[model samples]
Target: MQKRPNKISRSRRKNSAQTIFTRFMLIVAFFILWIGGIGVRLVHLQINQHEWLAEQAQDQRRNQVKSKQLRGTIYDRTERALAMSVQAKSLFADPAEIEDVEGTAKKVAAVLKLKPSDVFNQLTKAKVENKRFVYLARKLDEDAAEKINDALKNTDLRKFDEPRFAGLHWKEEQKRSYPQKTLAAQVVGFSNAEDVGSAGIEQSQEGLLHGAVIKKWQDRDRLGRVYDETELEEDERELPKDVVLTISNSIQYKTEQALEAGVKASNAKSGMAIVLDPKTGEILAMANYPTFDPNRFNEVAPESLTNRAVQSMYSPGSVFKLITYAAALQENMIKPDGEIDCRKGFIEVGGHRFNDPHATKVMSYGDAFAVSSNYAAIKTALGLGKDRFYNYALEFGFGSPTGIELPAEARGQIRPPGTWFGDSLASMSIGYELNVTALQAASAYA
Candidate 1:
């Protein structure tokens, strides 16, 4: 009995030791896993998520503001301002800083002719969303802005003192003005709200007209209040250069009036007219019907904004015969007094019959050209052959843009010799299949 009791005590002691050893191993494993998890989290935060956390922290205490300089003025040859930028005011607010949103909205609405309830809603929404800056009005007139400024300053007055607008502020902005209204609108083009030119000379000379952009950094306090606004000076800042066009405003007006009258009298859909100084290749005037005022360009159709003189392509008709006759004369294939058989007033070539409106028989080359006889021109072009005619067309600036300082100028279509159809020569002789811009035709005549 003593031996059996000793055996049982030894077995209980072994089991107790085994249980303790298992618990110790489990605790050690758990501690190692916990340390590993902490190390991995530290590595992710320090390396992978470092930039993202840093940006979030920086964004809390810094803000960027953009200040725009005035865009350059566009002047005519007489130094008359066609387009200019005038100093104006843009109203903005910091919703977080506003004390009484309703009062401020009502006051601003009264001055800006806006709906008070709408303004109030916008202000309240911005505040709820924690927006720092919100625009109330952009590019207000100087006089109107001054009135608002005066109202804001008169805080001691009975009406002004009760509902004070705390965060309303005005910043200097530029508004583009066209002094002459619709005069030379297409030639001068128009700039958008950001002072970027959209067409005409404005677009072609965008580099010279666009001004330097000023960047400013503002610091904020712990409460998110902005302070210490600083402008960073850039070495590349350059004052915008003005563009002086060769267009004459007076002549442009006269031409525009005449074209308008003519189109109205004839009941035409639309018309275009261009005046140029042959001696200097200067465009004195370019006029198009259905014009729009640059000041109100946003309200007009896109088609009305096009400069038709350089943009539209049409068959030159009789105008192109000058080139053909000149080519024939230059090539010694026909003389000024050379006679061509035009008694029939019509001729057939490449299975196409071309008819002349003039009812003349045999006549001199000069007479044929004077009457614009299609038969004479076709015969002359045929005699000159396709190669010489094509070469002369290229030399006369056909089938290409005139390289004018205008946007969207069309390079009139001219098919190569290989692409020419069997009746191409006959059709092209009197300007049937060919296309040319008005500027190109004028340049050719010059």
Candidate 2:
């Protein structure tokens, strides 16, 4: 009976141990399954999340800028169009969408008057697989652009059933034009490809020239057809205001004719002439040698862009006598009949001999000026002293800008009285040793 009890006890213990072992194994298996599931989840997060996350990141990075497309028109005094933008077609393409690049490029180039090989290379070289858009040309005329659109309509280049190019990217941009051509080539100036003024009135009035250009975001389809977003605000196109100038065409033409003749006759490198109405400060005429036609400005040399009238300086020759005479009269240092001797046609001042083109035995201040007697003028200037002469020169607008609306006008020099050493006073009296612009001389006379 004792042996039977022990055997039963051992059997019960064995069964209990087996049950615990099975439970332990099951718990371990469940732990393994949980760990495997967690690892698979981690892999999915690391690998598969990037594409969706990257797309989200790109969406966040996308920004829209409201670009403006506004421009101003330039007009003459008569309200004629000198420069303005016109509606034109800007040609573009999707190279990857292009099936027959060579054939299409040939047709496009023929219509555009561009080289076929060049066009083919440009279109094909953008990308071999996935480029969406590339520009071929801008500002095509209506006729050529229409023909291109017609061809695109009938072609098999489109990915969808609709026309491929979406009827050419026709948009209006400002184009510079000089209607009168060379009438005021240097004055009106020219605009570059970007419609920015480079010089002349165009440069001075750039802010007025480029008004504004507003652009709104547009949604594009798979075929690249564009439509304005519903939420986009409307902005009216504001035309640029016209500028009235002090320049006149009639006198400008006459001056140009006279200047061309003078430039040829002088056998000089170049020449310029500017005629201003002194009473009103209006520029009646401004002309230069080797002038260019603003309409065909690209054909001209870069040097022709300069306006020589305001930019040049000369000695002013005998014309400066008026300044000396004016100084003497204004200072009351010499009357019109004031006596001065020039028998030997020379006078010694500061140990320097000054002579005149004409000999004056003895002449009055009036005769001295009438004949441009250099010696008599020198004596008179020396008597008037340096301070009065220099002061008068400054008053007449020497060594200063003429306040003309042109760029780069020269400021002629009048040496200060303190700097007038040795024979400078004597030489300056005869219009030597001092530099003056023609504009200054004319102002002095006026």
Best by TM-score: 1
Q: List the residue pairs that clash in candidate 1.
A: 343-361
List model 2 lDDT by residue over 335-355, tens digit each: 898877778877788887776
Top-lDDT structure, candidate number: 1
Q: After superposition, how far is residue 396 of candidate 1 from its true place, in Å?
A: 1.5
RMSD of each: 12.7, 9.8
Question: Tens digits of per-residue lDDT for model 1 on 291-343?
Answer: 99999888999999988888999998889898999999899899989898887
Q: Scored by CA lDDT, what does every candidate get?
A: 0.86, 0.72
Worst 10 residues of 1 by lDDT: 156-165
Off by over 4 Å in 1: 1-66, 99-103, 117-121, 151-164, 215-232
